[model samples]
Target: MGIEFPKVRVNSLINAQTRNWDVDLLQALFKPEEVQLIRGISLGDVSARDKMIWPHTQSGTYTEEICDHCKSHSEDIVHALWLCPCLNEVWEADTGWSFRNTVRWDDFQKLILHVEEVGLDLDLFAMIIWLLWHRRNQIKVGNSATSLGQIVACARQQLQDYNLVQPMKPATESANLHTAVTWSPPRAPFLKINYNGAVFQDSNSAGLGAVILDSVGGVLASLAENIPLPQTVADMEAAAVRRAIMLATDLNLSSIVLKGDSEIITRAIQAEEQSLASYGNLIEEIRLHVDSFLNFRITHVKRKRNSVTHRLARHVSDLVVWMEEVPSHILPVLLTEAG
Candidate 1:
């Protein structure tokens, strides 16, 4: 029940065959690990159940199922797991591990389960499922998502950092500490601006941003936005970047900071996630925006450092987890590291 599945989807997938989602799907999706789990994860008291296929969508069907991202028919388990090009990047980003292009439906289960039993982080194993479902949802909804690298990047920001923001030190004290007649962590403009996308299903998607004065206190912009956006959240983030840059331009400030919780979008802006094909256009858009700024620079920052924006983003989530019992897809899935 602690799992982050949408209740409607969860209930639609299950009725009452059994409640062992972990064991059922784990066994069905992964065979090699069944034996490994016999002694693998040291949580000695756990039990594996055979009828544990939790609420879920089956892979592959003779009936033509169209993928939302690609115009191709959704080819069941094989396509969802190992076939889609969109998912290809997710695997590498998720594990720094990749699968051969030849895996089949039966093999996918093995791979899915294999990833589980291989003595990895439990959170990681679950993230693979969440990510897979996310891609599947994208396909179902007719929207495009970034590469798996991008999705992994998205998950990376969901991690929660409990630390309170460090209070600003007095300029006199900070100067004394940094400029101590010794070496200084020279601060020309360590400032970073962070943004977040507050997306609402079937409604407007908004973005939030703030300017931080390096490790110290930060200031929130008076601006808040809501605009009609394309289906995919990454696209929304891309748009958010555009908005951030526009805001910076309007402020007429040079040497300003740019930041966001979206690593895929950030990477696209940084040109790290670009190649010859898919992301080039988006990258160019970001570059054009960057060109408009005089001394503006963009960098990645942890979501924790960008708390003000997170608060700003909370206002407009239409289908964004209304029930207290479940977590919304928009309500980020926190990962251990930021890409």
Candidate 2:
């Protein structure tokens, strides 16, 4: 049975003398495979010293006790790792971990089975379970449990390493390649807004910048502001788009073209793809705001063509806003695009 569980509980259950145990309780509580293991272990001599061994540890020993999480619930495979109070903390620490509310899970097996039914990534679920178990063990051994940051970092690194070791998927190649194109002004009477977000990972800060231009590339308004560092690049990009929409709406801009370099954001806005990523809530908010505009379209532009907005996004300072003009530093690039 492929399920998430701790090793110590398994050891204790297998090695314990269960002559007076209720067979019905055993069958009801465990899977068929687990029940078989119970029967086999019951046959072992009671005098045999019951030793708990965890292969990963140098001592090859494990401790069985109440849950380190709640210190109240019995420390069993299901309770210790998943049902404990710490479960929510671990999941909330990483923004990437989310599940649909329509589905319910009372146990780890039920959760895994539901994920499979919904075609969720099995590998990701397995990795998260492993990390949770590892975290639990750390706490049990008198070591502090790792932060959500550390757990997420370890999981991401392991996934990246695994991908690197595997063979790459083939890319579709076209015989004809098109030349790069610069950003084109929107149709007359429509205002164009170019936006980008820059993430300073080391500082855990992000900058969002947006430039509003008329049909002829004349700067109407431009603004740059700092935002809380989002968990992923897509989140930052989506935030930039959301801010642009809000700003444009405030100015009563009826018709607008919003452009960004991220294809993922573009697809999400166009409804061509599902908004199921870490930035899904932002994507949903963007959609609601799009309806507020008289006319709005989200399009993808190459990074080079988006230089003006990109440069505006590079900062780790307080929020700054410019109206009816471009910043002095970005004026040259603005003139170039306008020319």
In candidate 2, list every pair of residues with a backbone clash: none
lDDT (CA) for every model shown? 0.46, 0.66
Q: All candidates: CA RMSD in angstroms?
A: 20.6, 23.7
How high is the lDDT of residue 87 in model 2? 71
Question: What TM-score, to 2 decimals, does candidate 2 have?
Answer: 0.47
Residue-wise C-alpha lDDT for candidate 2, range 79-114, written one tens digit per residue: 665556567765666444455323333334435545
Which one is best on lDDT? Answer: 2
Reference-based TM-score of each model: 0.39, 0.47
Which residues of candidate 2, in runs, are more than 4 Å off?
1-180, 272-274
